[model samples]
Target: MTQYQPIAAAAAATEWWRGAVIYQIYPRSFADSNGDGIGDLPGITARLDHVASLGVDAIWLSPFFTSPMKDFGYDIADYCDVDPIFGTLTDFDRLLDRAHALGLKVIIDQVYSHTSDRHAWFQESRSSRGNAKADWYVWADPKPDGSPPSNWQSVFHGPSWTWDGRRGQYYLHNFLPSQPDLNIHNPDVQEAILDTARFWLDRGVDGFRLDAINFSMHDPSLRDNPPVAPGAGPRRRPFDYQHHYYNQSHPDIPTFLARIRRLLDSHGGRFTVAEVGGEQADREMKLFTEGFDRLNSAYGFNFLYADALSPELVRHTIDLWPGAPGEGWPSWAFSNHDAPRHVSRWAAPAERKACAALSMLLLMALRGNVFLYQGEELGLPQADVPFELLQDPEAIANWPNTHGRDGARTPIPWAADAPHAGFSPARPWLPVDPEHVPLAVDRQEEDPDSTLNLTRRLVALRRREEALRCGIIRPLDLAAPLLAFERGDGPDRLLCLFNLGRAPADWRLPEGWTVIEAVGGEATGGSVPPLAGLIARRSA
Candidate 1:
């Protein structure tokens, strides 16, 4: 049976994404239904209560479309159907129905940048250059010297071009060769991608999370990308050595985004957020969401996948866009499917559990919408994936140099004693970290001071504070290790302070300061001078 719902004009007028907190659940590991050792739609449906209890405005589900699971589900085999591993389209419909019933908006992933080599479109396109779908993907002839068309490099490693023996041509791939980049330059391709979005919109999806959107456009001349000066930063792949100018972030991307925006507009206020990064994240994020005619918002690697969390780093990323420059606002995520859990990444295991909760508080304290990764509220650490069990290509290719995303994608721990920690009765696709068992949902549900409770309280608090909801950020000229700022909306103001170090620091506020909110590593004490954090609202 099909369950249907419609968005009212009144609700649509307000735009659900502004200051909305989205909880991201990676289906492959969220929970397992039927004990299949793999998570599916039914598993996520069973966990809806948990997601709703967090008071999130919506849920952002990572890809679960029909695929070979090459890049998990980013490689789509079918545009409209659900992968058998996750369940059928009916199950997806039911999940959306239930999510809506709980007042949670449903936002799903749309990987428009590429398609699986096995897709029907790719199959027909690769069959012959004169075929109806010939220009659907970015295909080019080998150079006169019999080499690839350009020096662009794939994220997995080596060249971005893959030799197609059947067509005797080279195909462009920004990530995996199995995932060929689509030719957004083609009008036909644009219509086809729009149709994909229309399929979900017709099915009542509230929005889309556009994967690698900036990569949708490529240089038409097939020029070699210039190499970037080498020094060590977060990017380990040699792909980072180049500036990535010709390969991606072309001027034509904004034009394509407008087309996408128009499709989303037909649904009236549907939210679309792009995942953009590399050399031009700041510029591209701004461009991609320059106006209401483009995407609703965009998130970058500014915090997610970062190896550090210094005060200066946090201030710099926020300073890029105060939301005054662009019509589209920004979204922030500290952890997601791609990055290691912030707890394990930012703090030592001994104090990570407490520090993790504090980080969530800090994330909610920021000026933009928040994206909370599934299991993050439980303070789960990264699973230790053995070499033989690795699934991420980048993780496998780089080995010891990188901690493959496999660790973070492990099944969600739902019970302390159940088999595979209640994620599944059978063996899971990825091993549940033994350390995560203690932090299972059931275990933390009863603890009032648990990270789960802290998240619930913080999210609820954020929902109530207008100043923190859509306020402008005012940076206080504070010292390092003591991060201080204010979120103000006219007369209402919130003074936020965080001790980024292990030891406490003091700050003498200007005269007439009154404490409103107190924050700390483990407690929120409002005492003056030595008490770590202070949130003072001006007394009118």
Candidate 2:
């Protein structure tokens, strides 16, 4: 067992989550301990050493609660118990204990927006109209013509409302039909969800990553959403046809968030980061984390779903949050379980290494907390899951039009020579990408200059420099292909520059600044190489 070195009490007391690097682990694809072809809590516990070595402050795990595997754990059946496939509650406790021993905070995903149809609450709600849990889920009466209650659409594809013959009405679902939306407007529902959070806190969880928080509350009147303009990008499903105004992003969400914040405040030093995405993501993200009374931070799809990485995009996104008074902190993620790996999305095959290194430097320099996905440190690209093995409901629904999320949720490559990349002794849930074999953790550990090691160095650099960790961001005026910014905190000032193009670029060095760290390419003769990133500090 490795000795634990706890962070200083003084630094953690104020705010440890600000500018923290959180590594996200998609539990189903991370590792399989029992060789049942599924990743479990014990698997994650066994892999804690690798995660702790990355210099990340915490680990944000995806849902592992009891579920029917319809949404791969997202459709949670039990809010308080661990799934049998992921191991028992004891296994979770052991995992949490091990993580805390290694100085890593544990942040679990909280899906308060909906629950599985098989959940006890939902089963009872859908059983009879006047049962104990009758109004636990969003239910509405059908129109006289017998169509859905409104024009709302599920994220999976078709109508959001499903007919429930037993209740003689329609039940709303923002996602799959099996995952019914919770009636958070009900005070009893709010109390039950808050109790779930309290349960986890009592069990020693450090924080929560609230999933699809904006979808928690919906328009009570069930008003129709207006259609979007004709040329609003490609529309694979009916969900993209509308502006999504009334279906979600209701004003009552913040009131519920305040209740959650109050509960977390009682726990002390705990954090909460809400995941808000959609057309109104920017506004809702700010609303959810605006003051000290709500969530600590919020992240949207600013970079996750972007087609390209450009200077204008970076500037525009960073400009949204200025860290002014009363404004909450921001969190950023380029790649996660839901989105395609950024290396494949942004860079060509030939320049992936350089692009990965540059992206890491850029993420570390950004003025917010950063999230790195499971295999991101290895520079892993999106896997090519075949049609036969497709498991994601959304991908299977809309075939070739939408490249589904299964490609991004493939198993992580742990060993270069082992079968299934050492993820499981048996057949894994998702196939391992052949290209990822060469970039496995075992192979990268042997090479000191590998992407995995580079990530560690970058994370350490951010931790060592106060300016990079919690400094104010000031965008520098630069031409195309070059994105430059300065992070300053009193006397500590650092200038960060990145050449996001395939050609070399040059910038006149400031009089007092000197290069402190250079990755991917050298910064010499007042020029930066292709896909290079440079960090320089001003001399006192």
Candidate 3:
């Protein structure tokens, strides 16, 4: 008998992301197969079993395309080819082949918003005014005073345009100057991006995790964004002090998304998930994933870049879309390549590991697709990377304010005692923290109650429970500082309670509720006289 029994069951499968968890592996830090101190495709291939064992539905590999490593592989020189630093096309095929064999769906990052200045298309576009690809990228003429097209600001700081003397025009770059934004308004440009998607689809990729999809289409008129008054907290950067009306979140983006969705639909059930960020993410996430005709799902930076993790905050995030209709789904990720590790950001040393483990349980209990970063299961805290060893351009450019992304991009420690923590025999690209040495996979593998075990069990538990997967969420009114909710599938209901405070809190349930998974403390009946936090299953 096959694991998938019927064709129709597979075709109409709610298993697309039904309580499914995705593991995000930053390629450069995952594993170094050739010991060049940098990770390669083969390195990831060598570790598919580790990922499969974690009970995740899929694995999302970050950018490995050819580039100058200016913004680490986010600046793509070639969209269809793998970078030499990460091995060859053959290596990626082998990795994908192996991952599929282990029952893991492979999803690769698609950076369609921008391309590196060194890309052939951009090179040709900049060469002349009447070139075949002159309109392939966002090229604009200078204003009356010779300033950029608009006052748009780059995410990396300073202005969003850089002068290109060759073309006698300014290029719009939402990120670094080298990362010129693509012209999505042009039909040929959209076709080229779709063709790039097809290249990977032809290689048997399960789906695509679109990087900054909202950034693909910008305001064609180049309208200036109005200044925003400082709201709650002190404004960190000038970029945050604007409504960002012009630079991104254009009305025409949904049409482009529908076009992309049509292409993916041609491949028979291939999924598309977008990464929506910036000030308007809350609004854009809904717009980008409004209908099934557009993106299958979209995740925002709501919880990822947060400094504090409270029950109320988590509840508010889930309540953002009470009952999302049509094809739009929400994917939640607490940690990723960007931002500091959640362990260090949310908790202290003594309780950080336990709190991190509990977070996994909470994430699994949530009513959305969950994305787990590679080292998150092992409770890996953000490591320290000195300025001398930092390879991240963002960190180097905005050193004092941003703190760079290198610390979170360090090598994944497979063995505590191995040379370079079993990531590489030679010195890794980003140094692994000495404190992270003991928290390696090998050490946690044998321990049943370790964070690794908790991740595996929680994922498995979520998979088994129907109410926990594709059910409707009902927020329960519990005491203060405690987040409680009920996930119900008709007759079955699961009551989830989380004590956000440090002290023990009593959980008063209305009726019959059985404690299923307890995080820290105990629970009894529908009410626990002294309940810390727990996940309880109930029947109507």
Candidate 4:
């Protein structure tokens, strides 16, 4: 009975994302046109053909909005316009048209949590207390001792409050001081964001990835957050010491998300996925996307922050989202803009090939919308970006403390021998990883067994199999070193087995199972070789 549920829901018109594949493009690193050091909208437009070739259903672009680049484009100055460095709005139009032409839906990032202080709205809000726009941002009076209103810490490394002489009050910023949080409690602010969405929807964007949406609202009382015990998991910064209760995860966030959903629904078939991170992410993600009135899905940082991949970790993470009723759909990504590449993080130098193939296979087999970051198909490892070339603010600030994002964000290598690895004719804003040159798309395209080709085959495999898409994952109790699960829905059912360890694992296939696809090393109905991943289908 339960197996028939998703199969029924999967047939609905709005369920395109139920098992869709999304390719994420960090615009500035994807490609460069006009010989500029920076990649622009035209560059991404030229690369749509490649993304479409991977058989992904849609594309999720990291922020390319008007910004001062404080936190890259996550700190938006103009929600409705493309940043000059990323090319004009017309360039984006062409990109959207090309993406649709290739049958790929375009999903842009929307940062409603905060706006660049340089934004017209924030500038006016900070001008004077009695001004019309002053209350548009989060403004609170200082304590009698002129101290900050609360003990809330900014994610960047300091007090969340910044004193403003112009307003004679402290404005709250959950991130960088230059990026002030919007007062989402204000109806006008909500309308402004909705209008921004309307502008894009009317212009033809198919969807949006709401950035830090869980932080869209804050507790109005400005209560001090209680500290976590000392020595909380790798506490390198003050921001990691508290529960972050009063600063984010406000109860009212779902209301605003519903408004966003309503607007997206007005445009028809438009999707909205929230980027929900931090403590209480699971609960908040459910609330933000709980029903038909909210977002379609939310992706957290489970695998993104994991140190290693194992049977226990994979099982635990999969169980986190069980597709329970009233629970929103979940999305998963092994690598993305902010995350270090899994090929480097999870595999040893010699085992890199096996790791890439097995990981890609595992990622695609999971039951959710999967995101494949640019170059992930090519198994690009994290670049070793030296300190001199660091561009990411978080990376630079916590240099020795954190893994830093610059390594994973280095420009993609399109051609092994081309200048700047064919990312740009001029020097790129961030250095292209020398190691990535050998794994360039051009070189991998020549070899049928390359990770690039394997990725395409796996993508196609997932697309054609009903059991692989929109099915429920039933974890199988296997011994250590082997991970197995059965994915089933309606008339389609398949068994997936993975040998996670370096040694061969015994696995005589069940009586009725027949091999469908095998990679890394196949299971020959007797033993599964090291790093092997196999899919066996059940005969109807």
What are the C-alpha RMSDs, in order, of all predicted structures?
5.4, 4.6, 4.3, 1.7
lDDT of 1 by residue, 215-279 (tens): 98899998899887656455577687787899899899999899989988988868999999777
Clashes of each: 0, 0, 0, 0
Candidate 4 accuracy as lDDT: 0.87
Report the CA-based lDDT of candidate 3 relative to the real structure: 0.83
TM-score of 3: 0.94
Tell me the whole-model lDDT of each prediction, alpha carbons only. Answer: 0.84, 0.91, 0.83, 0.87
Which tens-of-lDDT digit does each residue in 375-414 have in candidate 4? Answer: 8999988888888889888777877888578888889999
How many clashes does the backbone of model 2 have?
Answer: 0
- lDDT score, residue 229, model 1? 68
* TM-score of decoy 1: 0.94
lDDT of 3 by residue, 1-540 (tens): 111111123423644754468899899999899989999899999998999998888999999999988888999999999999999999999999999899888989999899999999999999999999999999999998999999998887678999999989999999988999999999999899989999999999989999988888899999998888657444555566677888888889999999988998888867788999887887788888875688877886888988878877886787676653443567898899998998888877877776776678778877768899989999999898888887777787777767778889999999998999999999887898998999899999989878898888888888777667766677777766678877755457788887766665665654676777876656544444322467777644
Q: Candidate 4: where is the Cα deviation over 4 Å?
A: 1-7, 10-14
Q: Tell how far residue 351 is off in model 4, in angstroms.
A: 1.3
List the lowest-lDDT window of 10 residues for candidate 2.
1-10
lDDT (Cα, 0-100) at 235 in candidate 1? 56
TM-score per model over all chains? 0.94, 0.97, 0.94, 0.97
